[model samples]
Structure formats: structure tokens, C-alpha cells
Target: MQCMLRKQAQLWEGAVLTTVGASKLPKRPKVLVWIPEIGDEAIVRIRIRKQNPDLATGDWLLLSRKTDEMRQTLALSTDKKSLRFLE
Candidate 1:
């Protein structure tokens, strides 16, 4: 699958929703999704891009084409293809 590095709005100021597991505290880094879908609120194993700092093992994310501005806060799962990288 394709992965893009984008930002999502957050309820708290100065705090962006970088991943599925970003907290208000600054100590914690943002996270990315490994799978294409998050069934529950549990953390799942994922292969995130090295260039993205906000993406961690358990952070939330919004994935899609750059053209679409809509951001959906959800977890993801891998596709049938072995390839699991995002642009």
C-alpha cells in the first residue's frame, strides 16, 4: 500500500494527531499504522517509514492521496500484497 506523511487537526492546541497513539504529553512521539485497518483500540505491529518521526509502533494516522484534504482518524491493516509502504 501507499503511505503519505500528512498532518491532522487535533482538539488540543499545539498537539497534532500525528498517529493513532499521540498523547498530549510531548515526551511521546507520534506513531504510524502498520495494518490498513484498526479493529480495536489496541496497538498492532506495523512497518512504518523511517523518515516519519510522528509514526511509531502505536500512533494514529490518516492515509490517502494528497489531493483529498479529508482526514479520517482510524487504524490500518496490510493489504494482500506483501508490499507495505506509503508515499
Candidate 2:
């Protein structure tokens, strides 16, 4: 028998303003942040894996900036929630 392991992708560092439930999909949560390096305020949709109670508005985070095939939108890490609260 062969054993295989999948490695997790690295995420970019960033921060969020607030976390709000998506109106279309209540289960999905979205966040707002200002990426001065990229531009002004940008909205990032998040998929929580291991919920962190400390996660809140105006906190630093680790994000994944990978985009879809079209390369239009940036998405969070797929393996796990890379978001880390830095108070």
C-alpha cells in the first residue's frame, strides 16, 4: 500500500475590516479590508474551516490571493481557513 499526503497551499498576509454573512448565502461569510498595497478597500469572501473566536473587525489576517481561471477574483485558501487574528 502506498501512502500519500497533500500539502497545504501558502496564503498571503492581509487584514479584514468586518465579517458579514452573505445575503445570497447565509452560510458564507464575507469580509471588507483596505489593501493600500493593492488599492483601496477590497471585499474578500471567506470560508471558515477552524473557527477562531478571536477573529473580528480591524484584525490582521493571513489570506490566499489565488484567483480563478479567469484571474478576476481572489479567493481564500481551500485546504483550511488561513485567517489568523492579530490583535
Count clashing residue pairs per candidate.
Answer: 23, 0
Q: How many clashing pairs in candidate 2? A: 0
Model 1, 1-87: lDDT tens digits are 123322233345666434455655344223233344433333333334344434443443334212223332433432322123243
Kindly provide the TM-score of model 1 when superposed on the true structure, using C-alpha atoms.
Answer: 0.19
Candidate 1, overall lDDT? 0.35
Error of 1 at 37 (Å): 3.1
TM-score for all predictions? Answer: 0.19, 0.18
Error of 1 at 77 (Å): 19
- Taking all chains together, the TM-score of candidate 2 against the true structure is 0.18
User: Candidate 2, which ten residues in sequence have the lowest lDDT sum?
Assistant: 1-10
